[model samples]
Target: MSNEPDQQSETTTKTNKPSIINVAVAVIHHKDKYLLGFRNAAQHQGNLYEFVGGKIEPNEHAEQALIREVAEETGILLNDNTIVKLGRLHHDYGDKQVSLQVYKIELTVEQYEQHKYCEKGLEGQALTWVSKSQLLAGEYHLPAANKTILEWLKLPSTIVITYPLTHFEAQSNPKGAWLKYHQEKLASDSWVYIRLKDSDSESVAEQLMKDRPDILVILPNDNEQYLDDKHFSTTGDTKTTQQVVAKHLTHSTLIQLFDEIGSSTASIQSLPKDYPLIVSCHDIASIKAANQLAKARLNHNLPPIIGAFLSPVLATQTHPDTPPLGWKAWADLAELADMPIIGLGGLSPTMAEKVIMYGGIGVAGIRQFHQ
Candidate 1:
């Protein structure tokens, strides 16, 4: 068995007062299957399944600790260059609190073959490769903290953010074409963020949900008009809102939310725990505010904002007058975000892989979706 210890004990070693244990978790992916270990019953939150990783030593970089812990536990070496940050999450077990630095690593064919037959980790713990579908369907048990990680994993690498209705008005049947365009996106994509800047935008969004109930729809909740239905429930016979997986709050909306509720217990009480939130962030302050909302939600055992869109990664054709954040500046902004960052503005679906190289989980665009 591996000599490394579980984070539960290390978390409270420093003081009697509550201290957060810093852990580096690796979501090692090979195709659609994820490598996981079954924790021994003796350990904290043990007897359940967990990703391959351990606590971060004091002053050690998260990447360095991750490489060491994964190697020690699984005998699979990780290349820092290939590691992609999937952002972080904090969870309190009441007895102990933990801050997990999540990272993603896609294993090569050879690597997957090398480890496929290993039923037990180097630590003697049983290891299993779970498919994405099984994991999301709750076939395997995992800790509460790992719930948000699953949501991040569920997001596609390419997200389609639709253009406003005005742009589609040139078509002979504007409303019909608009809904059809986004509905067709579900053919190859799992997610679509409908951004309709029209007086009847709400109706259009509702139509899309009714037409494609299985699509993971993200509706724009940037104003008061969109806020009333942000929380969804299936209690009623047929609430179209039940089809939505999340609500997209622009940076302005986030500011207004923070200003009004001021990030207290009220913030957690006001937002629905069942519905996920996504935000638009441009700079450090906005990202910080989004993080505050996420942390507050998680504190209440709720799934936090699943992601944030950091826009203008490159200069756009429609907004040539505005300067882009560029890759370096974009990465800098992404570093401050605690949720998966989706690169928006002048990015194509093909650039999804490139976006991961610079700290974003996916790419979102208006024009690219139409193309």
Candidate 2:
């Protein structure tokens, strides 16, 4: 849980100037593997399987740097039409700091070689296509760079619209929506929108497996309204909602849902309990209920819970001027809570990738489920 900024010092003894500057790199992919190049005998000599592209000069933006560096090293002629911006990375090499902007560009085997990979004195070194499994085996050098590449690779190759089903009402058309969403996911075998509901918590939980059994099932919060008929709540004389939800969905699928900050502290007091997955969704409050719950569970020796910032869609209607929690707050909460948090608000798959890049699990939205 280190919060040290990954940046090098500005003053250098040799240059007497800050070595900090902007740099850009391209993560080129052909199919299941990524195109990785070995560093020449010049830079990081033994650093095997590093991403292509290089440093940005003054008066040049990240895109410009990537285009120039790719051509220089691989002789690939890239245009504004070809390069796609993925995201940016900030790292401190101790001697120099760089705000590394990353891009993902696709090329065919013929195009890659036609570019004259080693025409100049750059020295092609060695080029290979690496899969995620091989990358995770720790055979590659540059652990930090490998981690960055892994993060990008985990992202869904195709756009995924994730719907967060917190209630039956949120589904627009519950039965039909679930059927259609499930069929599409099964056909493509690519995307899924988790339905989070508590009505017939057991029956609905069972149907999840019978229907689109492969997709993940997230249980909705035990709000008072939903619990009134279900006979469950965090407080009062009744079985805690968490216990009921856990009992039914534990074996069915990975449970995903937000815990009310205030009640979560008491809800998850036991340790090493068998629960599929947990997400705490406490808003800005004095006690930081989510963090307290995570600490208590961690202290008791339970598994880590996923943290989430709950931005109510109703808030957009009532408080349009209020801004949702940004990446920094989400990252801070995840670090403090010692858990990965997902963005819960008005979000889509494209935005979810952005959230994950900024240190989150992903995005969950109620509106997204209907679509």
Candidate lDDT values, in order: 0.78, 0.46
Best-fitting candidate, measured by lDDT? 1
In candidate 2, what are the lDDT values of residues 1-371, reduced to their tens digit? 00111234422546655455666777776555666676544343244457776767778887787877777766666773355444444445455455556666767766655643433324444666677567656567642533444444443422233333332356777655654554454424333333344354444433433454344333433332132214323234232232222211121111221243335544454322643234435344411444455445444545334333344322343346767565566555443433344555556546765665555545554444333
Candidate 1's residue-wise lDDT over 115-154, tens digit each? 9889998868899999989988888888888888888887
How far in Å is the alpha carbon of 343 misplaced in model 2?
14
What candidate 2 gets wrong by more than 4 Å, as runs, is 1-18, 40-45, 93-96, 108-110, 113-121, 131-139, 157-188, 193-371
Scored by lDDT, model 2 comes in at 0.46
Tell me the TM-score of each prediction against the true structure. Answer: 0.90, 0.49
In model 1, pairs of residues that clash are 2-123
